[model samples]
Target: MTQTPVSKAPVFGAPPRPASDVSAAVGLAGLAGLMVWVAICRAWPEIGAALNLPGPRERLAGSSAAVLALVFSGTPMVLWSLLVDKVHLRPSTGIDWSAPRPLRAVTDGAMTKLAGLWATWGLIAFVYCLARWYWRGPYVFAMDLLEQAAPLLFLGAIPYVLWLDRVLVEPRDGAWHFGAMLIGREAYDREQVWHHLRAWSVKGFFCAFMISILPGGFGAVVEADWSRLGADPVAWSNAAISAMFMIDVQIAMVGYLLTMKPLDAQIRTANPFLAGWVAALICYPPFVLMGGGGVLDYHQNTAEWTYWLAGHPALLWLWGGIMVVLTGIYAWATVAFGLRFSNLTWRGVVTNGPYAWTRHPAYLSKNLFWWLATLPFLVTTHSLVDAVRNTVILGIVSGVYFWRAKTEERHLLAADPKYRAYHAWMGENGPVTRRLAALENALVGRRRGAGEGVVREGGAGEESGQGDRHPAQ
Candidate 1:
């Protein structure tokens, strides 16, 4: 007898791919600006001498100069977004440039917004004053810089608000709602006010951290001894890694600072969940739980890849190359954000570059690099207990990142439908996610089959017992 042919399972079809919130051109523009600034910084000494400029005859690698680099990097991005991308014309910007409101009509709204904006800044400044950490170490540099620029920023806000209001289609944004509540002259959504506060809190907290760390990486990259590094794989890798971090920091700093509606780079919503706040804050500054001596410190008794791989030239080279690649992926993930990168905030949905492969490319690459480079399981102490403890601690640290990824996803899923679509697409089509999904399905299928077998056997036993008891009936 011929058996009926079995039908093949239908192929998995991915959901429609969502458009990346930030355009490729915008990222390229920012990258171009960053490269220009790097070139200028690296050659500044020679350029200064050639021009007979009255400054130090050395590369401008000071914190002040590094701070100034923000201008070089940010200006081009802004110009390109406005002139090339025409981002201001987008409906998402909440602007109607063609029908600008009369100055008198927008003045009252602008003034109220200014009040809210100023109050928010004042509150942030007060918090900065209260936080003792802001006065110490790297944060001192940030404090100094912000202190110097406070007056200018205050003055600049006036014209910026006034000009923006004239073109804004709906001038009553979160900030306006906040101002209305404070003034008590108009009705306002409490949720909108809270959103406004959360957005600024993210900016306030992250901008300082980004600015504080900028000079360290910027100087390392600017002053790296390329000639000496080429001969040593470890040194070369370190330099490359530092340069990548410098790029990430520079781009991220620009992102935090340039949260303008016109560029369509404003924070759409900060993560409202407390769990998200905890997950993100614990990774940063004063609250970081993974730093040395902290509860989650995983570096105890550990030797880096360099030490363990020592004396093996081939292995060292291969390992160093791997580390550099991981770091590059992490940096690329940040760059893909362009001006939208910020912690616990949904500026936009990024579905390009490293993100196209995995939803948490930065965290994945970063955690992998840490594991590979630290080699926590191979401790310097040579004690199994130490090795196990270190390994477990590092695993916990990785778990924290996973927690962060989930929290971020939770925020984005609720905030934007585009992100929901992107999430679905990633689950089906993403290189890493698709394989994970398939494995999960396989495991689940096996479990269901085992459960069914148990049920069938139990039912069969019940039938056999009943048949035996009813044999006479």
Candidate 2:
């Protein structure tokens, strides 16, 4: 039998395939994936439409992006794989150098991102207001108006910065790799993730404050707003937006567990907090970048904001509530499905908690959860504008994620051999079986042994843990 590289975290037992030879893999995968898609279209037009068929223009753009991405990323992965194959490169090869990630897209990423950390347009308005206030007791301006126009400016920055960073900086990154690569993130070590998480925690706090506090601060400062902060629709809307942002954070923290594999175990057992911090840190940087740009600017400036603002209370309030609830379910399933920690592969699920019943409660839960995530923004949105934005940002991204998951599922099914049986027992409803099994697991755990927890592993009277096997009769 062939042996795979021993990863720091336990995986669901991959067949020890070599890491993609970045360049060749991309060339192969892209050609293969496209050919497969073409055949699918020829064979199954219904499925093609179901995948949200893109227009000619969008298809061209996407295909170009995919090709460029394949080259940029595939080259590196291919190089690394060759290095491993030829030299047997060890995991310890990555430099441990600690450098600050300067927010400068072009500057060495080791420096702090001081210049572009805050939304420039909003900052200009804010700073201008502050300057006026210092000179004159207070000033008046439709600050929110400036915010409305900022999205276009912000969205434009992504491609530009990605280019600047990769071209000028020492780091060879992409959008997926901070933008240098159009696909897949290089896995970092446990310590690297921890430090990154610390950075993320600091930034997340600032972001939460920006979302929740900025509106209140602005409202209190405005002469009309000062008299009735709550009365102002924009102020109320801001509060709601901020609240939802935090709620989303909590949801994402748990939501990530759905995609986690077995290796996440080390995080759970060795250091959960650190693992969580890393996950949140990496996952949320995209939002932070958006925040720095005051992501909603484009919508606000172009009547889109006004339209959304006017309808936001109903749109966001109603749909946001539903999203929150579904997110809550996903969060619950995070633990219920044995999805928490480092899920490198399928082995993470076991006899414990939700695993006794359904195979992937979190999978379908996530399917619904992604839709819920979109609902909040949709509720506040009107027209095809909002629809298009959500389609690309949320829908497309989520769809890609699900597609990759199916691939991983296929790999797991092949690896475990018994996965089909387990899945059959669980049923396709996903959560239904897992929910019941989770309840039973809890009861069994409670009765079988005190608060120590239920028997998670397949072994009798023993909890399932990484590497723990089922007791032989």
Candidate 3:
């Protein structure tokens, strides 16, 4: 798992969030400004008309737009400030300081390659759109494709730019170099970067898949005339919930794809637990794609969504609010990971954002929501014992997630000392661990009782009880 080291480097550095970079500044500022604009647009009508927004529907949309603006604009500046000011990373070059000619040529070559690829792709996309316009009535335009493709295109393009820079600077044996190519001053293993590239690509594709499906869902919501909010408020709330979840997914996918800095070395290898793999597989699409029975379907467990609760306005609002907050926290945790986000592996030990307060914010919030939403304790059967059994079965699913958390810790602890240190810190400082310890003791006591009962049921003699009893007894 050792990465190949880059040789012969001395390039000058530039800040990623330079004040002089007008285009970058404007782009980010524009996004933030647009959010403010949207907030004005949505809020103005309500303010001017004094419209009532009591239910979850309109309130959810308004809140989402406001939050998205902060996420899009604020996150980048914060991350940039951290990298530049806190990390204090500087750019360096491999070429000798005197080799100005080689540097110019290398830069020219890399730029030329990038320009050529982009132009070729642009031309092809344009032609495709043109053909579609002529042959099919009201065809999709280049702008439409660009709108959808921009974020993904950036994800792929940035990596290529970094890879090209690497290639130019650290040429293969006998490869030509124009001048010294600039890269991060810190030494990063070539193989690790390659792994990151592969990981990001895979994750990006998955994100793309998620992003692609969301528009259709939104389209369906829009067509349904959400403003009416007529018959079923639960349905409206569900749509809003789905929309918020989709937006969260979009942010995470986009951020994860974009955040790999060329010099940000992969700190550790991915060593996932078998339990994590199994638990994740049972829950996500891979299992369903493989035609495994949807053994862990949420819909099935959510039989707890009773007709009584659904009809009660107060209950609906309460449940809806809880669900929104839980999902929001889950999404926020992913956002906190920023570029280090990955599935089934500890990409990096994030101690910022939601991670600053709690280690498993996503898992904790999500499982709590599952328990509330499923209401397993309320589920019923003609046989009282059967009802309890069913509730226990549903409860076990959430328990599996607890096992996942432990497995994650073990895997991460093996990968880096940071995770081990993080675990120790959590043990000392985390609020949830104490509650868990108390619950564990309670469960242990109950289990001992059950085991003792089983021994009695098996017709063990008094002598057997003497052997099994506590030493004090």
Q: How big is the RMSD of model 2?
A: 23.7
C-alpha TM-score for every candidate? 0.89, 0.29, 0.55
C-alpha lDDT of candidate 3 relative to the true structure: 0.44
Better of 1 and 2 by TM-score: 1
Among all candidates shown, the one with the greatest TM-score: 1
The CA lDDT at 41 in model 2 is 27
Ordered list by TM-score, greatest first = 1, 3, 2
Global local distance difference test of model 2 = 0.33
Output the better candidate (2/3) by TM-score. 3
TM-score of 3: 0.55
RMSD in angstroms, candidate 3? 14.9
Candidate 1: regions farther than 4 A off: 1-16, 439-473
What tens digits encode model 3's per-residue C-alpha lDDT throughout 277-339?
565555544343212234444333235553548668877777877787877777666555443
lDDT of each: 0.77, 0.33, 0.44
Off by over 4 Å in 3: 1-205, 216-240, 262-268, 272-275, 288-293, 298-306, 377-390, 441-473
